[model samples]
Target: MQQSNTYIIVFTAILTIILGGLLSLANQGLKPMQDKSIEIDTKKQILGAVVDVSEMSNQQILDYYNGTIKSIVVDYNGELIETDEKGSPIVAEEVNIPKNFKQQPEDRQYPVFIYHAEGNDDAVEAYILPMYGTGLWGPIWGYVALETDLNTIKGAVFDHETETPGLGARITEKEVQQRFENKQIYDENGNLESVYMLKGESNPESALDEHHINGMSGATITGKGLSDMLKSYFSYYQGYIEKVKSEKSVASL
Candidate 1:
């Protein structure tokens, strides 16, 4: 009995050590690949937020992103300043093109992608910006675009957490996304209305305007959270948007 017990203990210890060593080796070996995968996925998500997935495949998306996007770092006030340009602080730089812009609070730069499609005339669209927020169960992120007026939503795409599967996750569904198509982000009076995920069902009568939409049933929290996220990010882009609008207005005049 004593010999058997000793043998069992020794076997257990040996197995534990072997498994631990293997796990450590695996992590070390996979770290670089894991990081690369994450980077690629990030690029893919950003692209999805900007472009129609049906329009491009994985490799095509990568190729288009590399070709069309130009990153620049800017300040909270939307001033384009070179962080690493002069001998100034290396902290104020933001990516203007296809770079990560999550450095400082009130001093971060965001990505802006341009997509050119051949339509009747040459149709040029700018993928305005992206923002991240907390959802009911996990993190929620989206990309919103603006028209030349900077008040209209050219397009948008959202993704979320575990949620309630068919309920909360519906924010990323095709039917729900279609609700935001061609919608204006602001009211006729230039109020920051964003987009509303209406409760129950969408009623054209109660919409903020012709562009407002109804929220999904059983997913009120997720819908509301998404609207709030849009509002907050729009605040960040207010300066930039205003500048663009002003420039266009001046051009028109």
Candidate 2:
């Protein structure tokens, strides 16, 4: 009996080792494909803000993103951050927005994606800004693309990790996102009030509408959360936006 027990233990140990090694090798082999998939998905989300990417293939999205968009990383003070402490150049797409949002709002770095017109280096069509915050159930994030004026929202795309189905999750739909089109972020007094979604329903037809969007019918909290995110991120990006506006003004003059 003792001899049999020893044999069982040895067999189990060897089997465990073999399985672990197999898993490690599998992971190593799959990582590159996984990373490329993630890259394509991220590009789709980013470009979906300004263009219709649903009909686009992965390679097309990659080509469009590479050809049409340029990105930059800016500090809380709105100054461009070109390199890290180790001297590796910082990349906007590589910035971990959710992790950065964990810090104080004033301490977070912002990523801006500039969308340029085809074949024209001098004409910028829009500036895309990424936003991150909590939703009713989990984390929510998206991109908002502003027109060259830097105040009007040209388009937006939002997604949540685990929001309720048919309610808060509706934020991921194009209908909800399109509501943000042409909305102004700054008020007449030059205050960055951000955009709000009223509870109950959308009031886009109201004459008084400027900074307000129609709220999700049954997802008031999610709507508010989205509004808060916009407000917070817009404030964080305000300095950079102001700098661009100043430069454009000078260029026009």
Candidate 3:
């Protein structure tokens, strides 16, 4: 009886080891594919902020991104710090927004993507800024595309890690996102009052207001999260916006 028990224990231990080894091997083999899937998804999200990418093929997305988008890394002072040998801005897609979010805004490397519309002689149509923040459940992140004026939103695309379905998750809905279109980030006095997601229905008269949007029902926390996220990111990019405005003013003179 003692020998039989020993054998049973040995068999169970061997089976466990074998299963663990197999699982480890599977994970190692899948890591590259997983990384690639994440990369493609991120590109899709970035492109979606500017154009309709819902029906775009993966190759098409890559082609459009490579051809029309120029990425740059900037400092808090709105100075371009990283550039290629030819004096072109390097692609800043690898700037890692989530990691940078934890650092002081001055210390963070901001990634900005300039989208040039086709047949427009390479004129920048919009600037895309990446944003990250906390939601009720987990991390919420997205991209906001600003018009060339740098003060109005062209479009926005948001995604959450673990928001509750039908509630906080509604922030990802198209209708909710479309509400951001044409929203102004600055006030009449030229103050940088970034757009906010209100707690409930905003005043209809204020619908044309530049700084507020009606909040989602039953998702007050999430709405606040979105508002906070937009404000924080817009502030980070404020330096660049100011620099562009200054340059435009000088050019016009």
Candidate 2 lDDT at 191 equals: 86
For 105-144, candidate 3 gives per-residue lDDT tens digits of 9988888888887545259999999999999989999999
Better-scoring candidate (TM-score), 1 or 2: 2
Residues 1-253 of candidate 2 have per-residue lDDT tens digits of 3568889999999999999999999999999999999889888999998999999999999998988988998887778989878999989999999999889977777899989986565679999999998889999999999998888999999999999999999999999999899999998888898888888674547733768878888998999899999998999999899888898899889
**lDDT string, candidate 1, 127-188, tens digits:** 45777676688778776766666776777778775777988898887678767777877787
Question: How far out, in Å, is residue 65 in model 1?
Answer: 1.2
| Each prediction's TM-score versus the true structure | 0.77, 0.88, 0.89
Q: Residue 74 deviation, candidate 3, in Å?
A: 0.4
Q: Could you report the Cα RMSD, in angstroms, for every candidate shown?
A: 4.7, 3.2, 3.3
Which pairs of residues clash in candidate 2, taking residues 3 or more apart in a chain or in different chains?
202-214
Question: Candidate 1 — what's its lDDT?
Answer: 0.67
What 10-residue stretch in candidate 1 is worst by lDDT? Answer: 91-100
The list of candidate 3 runs beyond 4 A from truth reads: 1-15, 83-91, 119-121, 201-208
- Candidate 3 backbone collisions, by pair: none
TM-score of 3: 0.89
Runs of candidate 1 exceeding 4 Å displacement: 1-17, 84-105, 116-124, 202-205, 208-211, 251-253
